[model samples]
Target: MINRTVIVGRLVADPELRYTPNGIASCKFRVAVNRPFKNEGEQQADFISCVAWRKQAENLANFMKKGNLIGLEGRIQTGSYEGQDGKKIYTTDVVADSIQFLEPRNSTGSTQNTPNYQSSTNTGGMYQGSSQGQYGGNTQPNYSRVDEDPFANSKGPIEVSEDDLPFD
Candidate 1:
């Protein structure tokens, strides 16, 4: 059975990062994904609860913020917990394995309802989508092979007047 899910959306707020007793990193955040179709001629959105574990969780909290567009890939997870009312509440969320930043263009900016999340590290920053889409930490990207150089022969060597180079 396929339980994997992928989604792209803006974060509703900043991610909250925490560490367990074993120092294992984790974070939880919600992304506001716009629907492909508008709702009643207005923008429709779906908020997804996502959790990142280990390094990915740390990285997300380190570099992601509210209002940023992000991509997520994970599995649907369901768990039950006892509420304060002594009732068992069942919850579902995405167990995020990979997350990519897609919008608002920063690590920390414009997050709504940001109360349940904060990073021990930098609270403000931006996240860029990686080629491998690895979560947390830095990954060396594979550069595409380019056959030609962009600046090889644009212009011949010409003696520039003192004013042309703008060194003055």
Candidate 2:
């Protein structure tokens, strides 16, 4: 079974963040994902729920706002519980593993409200304007296969027994 999912959308509203009993930070927000097909010249959108934890949650609360575009990758989870109205409420949301800012914030456009993201891996501590400072080099890891034989295994894709796999 495969449970992977990816979505790119805009936030429907400001995120609401709270701390768990153990003091772990968590945030919940909704993103409006537009439908691929147009209906009667109108574009449809689906409101998706997203959750972030720890440092990501804090950054999301501080940086994101309504109408800001975001890219999220996570799995979909569904559950039900009794609500305040004494009714069982079924809910579905993405348990986010990664979240990235897809666009810039308007407030931080001016010098008075400068963007506060940490400089890339270079430029010391000076503010990075517009291009956001590429710094010295790209932040993503270099994936050069220096090994002579990258895949020397005889088998291609794994087809293991039921006991060897986690999913049925």
Each model's lDDT comes to 0.67, 0.67
Alpha carbon deviation, residue 110, candidate 1 (Å): 9.8
* Candidate 2, lDDT over the whole model: 0.67
lDDT, candidate 1, 66-101, per-residue tens: 777677777788889999999999999888756665
Least well predicted 10-residue stretch by lDDT in candidate 2: 118-127
Please list all clashing residue pairs in model 2, or write none if there are none.
none
Give stretches of model 1 more than 4 Å off: 103-168
Name the regions of candidate 2 deviating beyond 4 angstroms. 107-168
In candidate 2 the C-alpha lDDT for residue 132 amounts to: 44
Which residue pairs come into collision in candidate 1? 16-117, 69-102, 69-103, 106-125, 106-126, 107-125, 107-126, 108-125
Q: Which lDDT tens digits does candidate 2 get at residues 95-167?
A: 6666766666664222233322321111211122546431122233323335476568656875768799887
For each candidate, give its TM-score against the true structure. Answer: 0.63, 0.63
